[model samples]
Structures are given as structure tokens and as C-alpha cells.
Target: MTITYEETRELAQRTVVDARYPNINIYTLDAIWVLYDRVLRVDPQRIDDPARDRFLLSKGHGPSAFYAVLAAKGFFPAEWLDTVADLESPLGSHPDATLVPGAEISSGSLGHGLPLGVGVALGQRATGHRDAQVYVLVGDAELDEGSNHEAIAYAGAVGLANLNVIVADNDSASHGWAGGIASRFAVNGWSTATEDMHDHDALYRAFTAPHPDRPHVTVATVRT
Candidate 1:
């Protein structure tokens, strides 16, 4: 059963209502939904397959959007949304990779996802999983972490063509990038695209655009 956008929104709202933390912002909802519904090649059933695309949610503090998308995609039961953050619930404010069916990593510690994604992309190449792609979704504010800068430079230096980064820029950064977030990646030899985060078709095109010899970064600017 294919879940429509309206259904996905309802699922997110359900989780939001059950949220115990104040950070359950649904800012990443549209981008996450678009990725799972249109772009990513990951399957809910074969999550452990080496050929599956890996999506790491680096900005994991507010994960209601993530959980909702996973549920809508059949990665887990929608009922879990009602119990989110409960003592015995698998769903928490931060997603647990082991607890969540399709999660690639246990995140929430800002700035780790991109670095881990670089390692995962390298591992895929080393293990002959050439067809797999590694994607990391991060927040603009999380980019303030030095670890991400290092990872961005390293990934670019190695020409990790199989790696893709989606930056959900809500302009929350303490020190904004001079030429915009996309320019930071572009200077590091990455193919870059900037689009409105709510523009599904534009998001699809940017995500699917080829960057043959380099990694890619799609800057999804959220409308305020």
C-alpha cells in the first residue's frame, strides 16, 4: 500500500502529539518524505542487504519526522507513533538504529552522521558493494561542528562519488556560510544543488542529478 503525502503528514502529526520533548520540529518532514517516497532505493524488507542505500539522519535530536516517514514506508508499525518516547517504546526522541527497523545508525550526537557516511561509503567500495549509495541528512546548524567540516573535506578529497549529502538549511547556524551552504561543498569539489525544501519535484531532480567524479550535496532551503 502506497502512502500518500496526506497520510504521511497525519502520521507525523500523530508522533508530534506524543512527543515528550520540545524539539519535535517537523521541519525535515517534507525532505524525508520525498527521499523515502521518491528518491532512495532502500527497501523496508531488505534493510540488511549490502546493496541497499543507507540514509543517516545526522540531525537526530528531533526525529518525529524520521519515525513518521519510516512508519509510512512500512519500516515499522504506525502504532509505534502513539507510543513515541514512552518508557517501553522503541521510538525515542532520538532514533536507535538497533531498535528501528530501517535506521542505518544510532544518531543524535551532532556531526557524526556525515563522518560515518564517509566511512560507510568507503566500506562499500572496499567490500565491492559498488552499487550502494551512502546518504547523510544534516541540519544547517549541525554544520557548525568541526567534525562535519573535516568529514566534508575528507569525502571530497577521496572523491566519494557514491556519497550524497542533503542539507536541511533553516538558517539556524551560529555562523552562516559566506556564499551559502552549497558553496561550502562546491569549494570542496562536490557537485551542488540548492532548492526549496518543500519543492518535491525540484528535490527529486537535485537528488537524482549525477556527479560522476565527485560527491554531491543538495541544499534544501526551508522557507521561513
Candidate 2:
């Protein structure tokens, strides 16, 4: 079954677990689907393969999209989505790696995904696994977390070419950067690309670009 963005987005809408925040962030989901479908090199059937790509959701608060993509990609059954946030369900508002079939790490609190992704990328390299890549998704607001800065700087310094970060820029951050988010990663020796998250072709090109001796960051902007 081929999955289009709209189809997966509809599945995401069905996974809404909270009533207080009722709207699904379709912008974020659209960006993620493009990256996952076009750039990620992981097999849903061989999810546990040591050489498989890793995808982590740093902006875990808005995870309906991730869950939908995972299920649509066959990481788990689509039926599980309906039980989200139920006491007996593993599909909680925030994903749990141990419980959820495709989650690489359990995340909800901000600022952890990039650091963990760096570690995973480094480990994959250190273990002689050359083909694997690590992709971490973060919110624009998550840049305020000092830990992300450290991870960005460190990943750049070490030249983790296999590590990639996607920052969903919705202008939600409390504080702003002068040169924009891509500059932060660029100055730290990472390759940076900025594009509209809804532009699938541009996103695919950015995600698949060559970043020799450095990490890669794609600043995907959405409407404010």
C-alpha cells in the first residue's frame, strides 16, 4: 500500500491523544514524512538491524505525526494509534521506545534527541557500521535548551557526517537567534540547509546532500 502525505496525515489526525491541544501540527508531519520516505535508509521489516538508520523525535510533544508515519511505514499496526494515551496502550501522548516498536528513544522533555543521536551516530561508526545514519527531529523552541547547543557543537567538532538534524521552525521559540537557526549549526562546522517544510523536492535534496567531514542540519520553516 503506497502512502501519500495526505493519507498519512489523515492517520495522524486520528491519533490525537489530547483534547486541550486539539489540532495536529500537519506542517511538522509533512516535513517528517518527506525525510523519512526519501532520505532515511531503514527497513520497517528489519527495524532491529544493526545497520539500519535511526530516527529520533526530539520535539516529542507533537508526536501524532511520528506515530502516524511509523505506523504507515509498518513499524506497528495502525490500530494501535486509536488507543493512544489509554492506560493499557503503549501509544502514549509521548512515545516510549521500550513499548513502541519503532521509537529509538523515549522523549517528551526537550533537548535530548540530538545528543542521543550524536551518540548513536558515533557508536555506529565506532563499531564499524559505515552505512547507518542518525536523524533527529527538534522544534525551534528546543534550541533554547543548552544541551542541544553542546550536542551541536560536539557533533560538528567530531565530524559526525552520519548525523542529521531537522529543526521545525514555527517561530515558537521564546528567544530568537540573530542569523537564524541554520547559522548556529553552520558556525559549528555543520552543513546547513533552509527550506519550506512543505516543499518535498527541496526537503529531499537537502536531506540527501553531501556533508563531508561535518554533520548536517535542515531548518524546515513553517508558517508562524
Candidate 3:
């Protein structure tokens, strides 16, 4: 089931306000609202539109946020979000692109989203929707895994500027890992910026800004 955009907004905001989803990150859910309300262009009905920008929440622990936004956007029925992640539901703990109308990637493992975004961008190019963007969200904790670096570098060097990387850096990865992520993105030739993800205005500005080159990386320093 899915929800209407207005209803989705109410449920998500209310859930966080009531503390219903304890395991779910409040800011992540907030980010979902930002995406659904302003950023992502996913159609309420035609979710698979080729020209639509695909948003992959690479940090999959934030499933609740995604579900809330999807329901709000009327992907199915708003009430069905309550059953999300349950045994009988189409929406599981991690987003499955096949089951969820707006989901573009099945995620949770963390290290694969950047590459997945790259692939999506490539496919869009092949299909002649070169103007479409493939946006991916990554977790700071997950950045400790070396696999992400390769994908990030690849997106940069390959000139996949249409693929946007939004890294939610909570600053808790190992000892020094998170500290250097933004700098690394810059050194690798990725047009990058670091901003407080909680600030809706800042987030919108950073994400919507054009990349000076191919492969843009926006490090959103969020607190949990």
C-alpha cells in the first residue's frame, strides 16, 4: 500500500515527533521528506519514467524514511507503510526496486550504491536519457569499507557527473576515516561540498547546484 504526498508528510513528521520508529534515524527520515517534497522527481504514478532521476538511498538502514516518503507519494497506499518491513509486506527492511515502485536499488550492504548509481547513469545514457541523474546516498559509517572508495573514484574519473553522491557522514567511522572523505572526493577530481544535512536549505542548495565537472560528491555531515 502507498500514501498520498500530504498524508506521507503527516505520518513521517508525526512518527518522528512521537518516537514511533526508534531504530529509524530521525534525520534520515527528514532527508526523505526533503527528497520527496523537493528534490527527487519520481512520479507518483509513473515511477519508472526514463527521464526521471533515480534516487538510491545507499544507506539502507533508513528504510523507514523511504517508506514514509513513498507512501506520501502514493506509490501504493499510505496505510501500507505501517506494514513495511513485515513478513507479508512488499516493502522489506531494505528497499527492493522490484517491489517498491519508486525504489531504484535493493540496498543495505552499503558499499554498492555508488557503483549502482554509476551503472544507472550508464544505462540512462545508453537509453538516450542522458540528462537524467542517478543520485545515491551513502552512510559515513559505511565509508570505512574500502569498496566505496573505488566506486567513488570510478564515478569521478569516468566523468559520470550525472551521478550525484550524497554521503551522510555521521563522523563515527573508525578513527580517521570520515575526516578525509570529503577531501578525498576533491582530490579525486569530484566537485564536492560539505554541509549540514539537517539544514534543509543548505541541503537543497548543495544538491541542486551544478557540478563543475562530471561526478559530483556532496558530503552531508549529519548527526544521529
Candidate 4:
């Protein structure tokens, strides 16, 4: 049975640990939900399949939405959601790939996910997993890291067609990019799309759009 979006939201709400970060995961809810629900080609039953698509959450400071979608999609039991951030729970404020079933990377530090994603995509191509795709979700502010800039430039230069990046833009960047976020990736030779994060159809189209010889980026603008 496919889980409804409302059910996923309720599952996310079940993970109430820190009062200080009450709404931390809200901004990413829709974007993650759409990926798990419609775009990603990962199977909960065969997580270790080499051909499976990879989704890395770079903005892992608040992963309630990620956890909820994983549980809803059967990556883990829903009961685990209730114990998020607990001392013994595998689920934490920042996702750990070693602990979480569907998590591809142990990410919490900003600006690391995109670079790691580039490596993963390169590995997949080298390993002959030509059809596999690598997707990385990053916060707008996280792009301020110099590592991501290098990754972006390298991915474009090498024409990593299987690599995709989703930037959750809530207008939170410390040093905003000129001509908007899409322009940053566009200038680096990447295919770019800007869409309202809340628009599921638009997001799906952006995620699946063809980028023949280069990596693609979708800047998902959301309400701050």
C-alpha cells in the first residue's frame, strides 16, 4: 500500500525530541516526500543492490522527514520513528548511513554531501552501473562551503549525466548567489531547473528531465 502524504507528515510528527528544533524538518518535508514517493528507484527490500539509485541527505541536521518517508516506504519499521534521537535509537538528529537502512551517507556537516555524491556517481559509472543515478539533497546555506563549489565544477566538467542535486532553497543562504541559485550550477555547465518545492508535478518533471552530457540541479524554492 502506498502511503499518503498526510500519513507521512503524521509519521514525521511522531518524532518529537528536541524543543529547540520543533520545525527544523518542515521545510524539507515535501521535497523528500516527493522523491521517496515518486522519483527514487531504490527498493527497501534490496538496499545493498549495486544498481539501486542513491539518495544522500546532506542537510541531515533535521531528518524527521527523511525518517518518516523511509519508514512509510518500509526501509525501517514505523516503531523506530517514536524513538528518534533517543540514546539507543539508530535514528538520530543527523542520519548515519551505518545505522539507517536506506541512508547512503552519514551526513551532518554542510558542503560534504555534494562532493561525496560526485564520487558516488563517478564510482557507479566506473563500475559499469551506467543506469544508476545519484541524488543529493542540500540546503541553500550548505552551498556556501567551498567543497561543494569544487564538486559542482568537477561534476559539470566531467559530464556526470547520472548525477543530480536538489537544493532546498528557503532563502537561507548567507551569501546569496547572483542571478539566483540555478545560475551558479548553470554557469558550471550543469542543466538547471527552478521549481516551487510544493509543486509535486513540477518537482517530478525537474527530477526526471533529460541532461544528456552533464549533471543536473533542481533548485526547489520553498516558503521560509
Candidate 5:
């Protein structure tokens, strides 16, 4: 069945609202759209096109929005989204790059995406694809891992101007409100921004602008 972007977006919102139990650490559907619609860029059929920007859903559980976006973009039949995470499904709860056309990395583990994104940016530079930007959408709670810091520091030191680290802060991470995450990124030389993650226009601007000589990081402080 064909699904419009609106339907895809709505289902994604409903899935997160209904799928998880009342008490769980998983991200909400609202948060999914907040980041996915705002930060990532893609063209499903031509995902591998050299001009297409790379998007890594580091907050892997937010597959609702990711799948919805891909479906709407015609990466696959829209009906396939209904089977996401099913035993027979190719669309897992977290994306599998080898399986998903638009995904840059396979991730369920936190703290892995940013480093991978950094690597992608480095690869882009080395390959003379300097215009391609790698964007990683990480969960604020995932920062519990020391590796997130390592990735941020390395991005700063390496000066990956074409890479973007987007932290989806949905006011639910770490006992409500992930603390000092923006400051952490700032200290590491990443230009940071905090705003309602659902604000699409603001996030679009943030995601598109390249840092002059350093990695660009935007921590979207969402209140979903």
C-alpha cells in the first residue's frame, strides 16, 4: 500500500506512543519526528547518489520515524513499515545499513554512531566528496557511555567540518533532562544549539550549515 508522508509521520508518532510500556527508557514517537524530520537529509531511491547527504540514526530505537521517512521517500513499499521489528521484517528496531538503503550505519548500541559518523566524514574528505555531510542522531541518555565523549573529542581534534552530531534531547533521558550535554559539546569545540526538537525549520538550518573549521554539533533539547 502507498502511504503519504503525512500518514507515515502520524504512524510513527502513534507507534512510539503505543508500542512501549508506560515505564520504559525508550524514546517517544514525538521525539522521533522531532529529530528525523529536522536533522536528516535523504533521497530514498537515489540514496547512494554521491550528492545525497548521509544520515545515521544513532538513537536507534527511533526507527519509527526513520522507517516512516524511508517509506514516504519510496525506499520501499510503505506497507513494509507495519512489519518493522517483526521476526520476518528487514526493518529492525534499529537500522541495519547493509539492509537499509538510506542508513549509514547499523546501530542499537549507543556511543558508536558519532565515531562512525566522524569516520564517514573523514572518508568523504579523503575521497574528495567534501560536500557530503554525515549527520548522527544520538540519544541524550546514551551519553552514559564514555565513548560518546571520545567521539566528540576526536571530531574536534580532527576538525570534521562536514560532520554533524545531533543529540535528541527529549526531556526523558537520565531522570528527566540530560544535564550539561550542550556544555560538554561546546567544551569539545563543537558549535551547539538547544531548541524544541520538533521545530523543523530551525533544525533544518542547523543541520545544513557547515562549521567553518570544526565539527558541527547540535543538541536538540526536545520536550516530547
Candidate 6:
């Protein structure tokens, strides 16, 4: 059951108790839903499979969207959406891997996702996992973190073919990149691309593009 943007948004809205922030990054959520629906590999019955695709939400501050998608995908109960951030709820502002059924990592402290994704991608290759793909979603502002640059350089150098990064570019970076985010990755040997965040078809194509012997990055631009 592929969830549409409208459906995902409605599901997410159910979890929003305060309208002030909505506790979700709507642009990133809408963009990423396409990747999960059209590109990511998964087997609810075989999550432990080494070849099963992994998705790490590096932009974790606004997790209502993540929880909504997970619930829609049957990662957990749909009812859990209403309980998010409540006292008994396992779902918090930032996803906790041990608590969230489908989350690969617990991330909120910026600049950690890409590095962790690089590690996952490298490990999968070393273990001879033929088809696993490791994906990380990051905010444009998070790129300011030096740790991400180190990971980007290392992943590109090692030719992490199984790694993919989707940077939600909302122009929130205090010190923005000169030639845009794609250029940074390109210089480091990554196969890079950019597309409007609202264009699901374009995003799908970019996200699925082949980058043999190199890591891939797709920057989805969102209006701030």
C-alpha cells in the first residue's frame, strides 16, 4: 500500500497537538515518503536480513512525519500516532531506535546521521551483503557540522556504492555552501543531484539513479 502525500500529511496531522511547530518537517517528510514507497527495500517479516534496506532519519527534530510514515507502513500501531510525545509513548520528538519499530538510529544531535550511514554502508559491503542500501536524510543546516564533511569525504573515497543521502535543503544553513550542496559531494567523488522537494517524480528518479562504485546524494530544495 503506497501512501500518497495527502494521506501521509493527514496521518501526520493527527499527531500534532500543538499547531505552533507541528513537530514535523513537512517538506522533508513529503519528499522522503517517495523514497520509502518507490525505492527503499524492506521486509517486515525479515527486518533482520542483512540485505534489507536501512533508512536513518538524520533530521530528527521534527519526527511527526517519520512516525506517520512508519505507522502507515505498519512499522507500529497507527494508534501510536496520537500518543506521540506523551508520558507513556515510546515515540518522542527524536526517534529512539530501541523504541521506534523501524528507526535505524536515535538522532537529534545534528551531524551524526551521514557518518553513521557511511559506517552502515561500509559494513554491509564488507559483510558481503549484496543488495542492502543505507539511506540518511539530513537537513541543510545540519551540514554545518564538521562531522558530516569528514563522513562525506571518507564515504566518497571508499566508493560506498550502497550509501545514499537525501539532504533537505531549506536554506536554513547559517553559512551556506558556495556552489550548493551537490557540489560539495561531487568534489568528494559522489554522484550528486538536485531537485525540487515537492516533485515526487523527480525526487524518485534522482534517488534511484545509479552511481556505481560511488555514493549518491540527492539534494531536495524546499522553500524556507
| Reference-based TM-score of each model | 0.96, 0.96, 0.87, 0.96, 0.83, 0.94
| TM-score of predicted structure 5 | 0.83
The list of candidate 3 runs beyond 4 A from truth reads: 1-10, 13-22
lDDT of 2 at 158: 84
* Tens-digit per-residue lDDT, 1-224, candidate 6: 76666887888877763346765556677666886678888855666777889998998887877888888877888889887778788898778899888788998899999999988988888899847888899999999999999999998998889999999999999888888899999999999999999898999999889888899999999876
Runs off by more than 4 Å, candidate 6: 1-3, 17-24
The local lDDT score (0 to 100) that residue 122 gets in candidate 6 is 80
Per-residue alpha-carbon lDDT of model 5 for 44-72, expressed as tens digits?
66677766678777777657777766666
Best by lDDT: 4
Provide the clashing-pair count of each candidate structure: 0, 0, 11, 0, 0, 0
98-137: candidate 3 lDDT, tens digit per residue: 8887788888787888777888889998999887877888
Cα lDDT tens digits, model 1, 51-147, are 8888999999878888989999999999989888788988887888999899999988899999999999999999998778888999999999999
Residue 159 accuracy (lDDT) in model 4: 94
Instruction: Provide the RMSD of all predictions against the true structure, rounded to 1 decimal.
Output: 1.4, 1.1, 3.5, 1.2, 3.4, 1.8
lDDT of 4 by residue, 129-220 (tens): 98899999999989989899999989998899999999999988877776799988998999999999999999999999989899999999
* Error in Å for residue 198 of model 6: 0.7
Instruction: Give a tens-digit lDDT track for model 2, residues 1-224.
Output: 88888889899988776656877665688777986788788888887889888889988886899999988888888999888888999988788899988789999999999999988998999888877888899999999999999999999998899999999999889777777999999999999999998888999999889887889999999976
lDDT of 6 at 118: 88
Which residues of candidate 5, in runs, are more than 4 Å off? 1-5, 14-41, 175-179
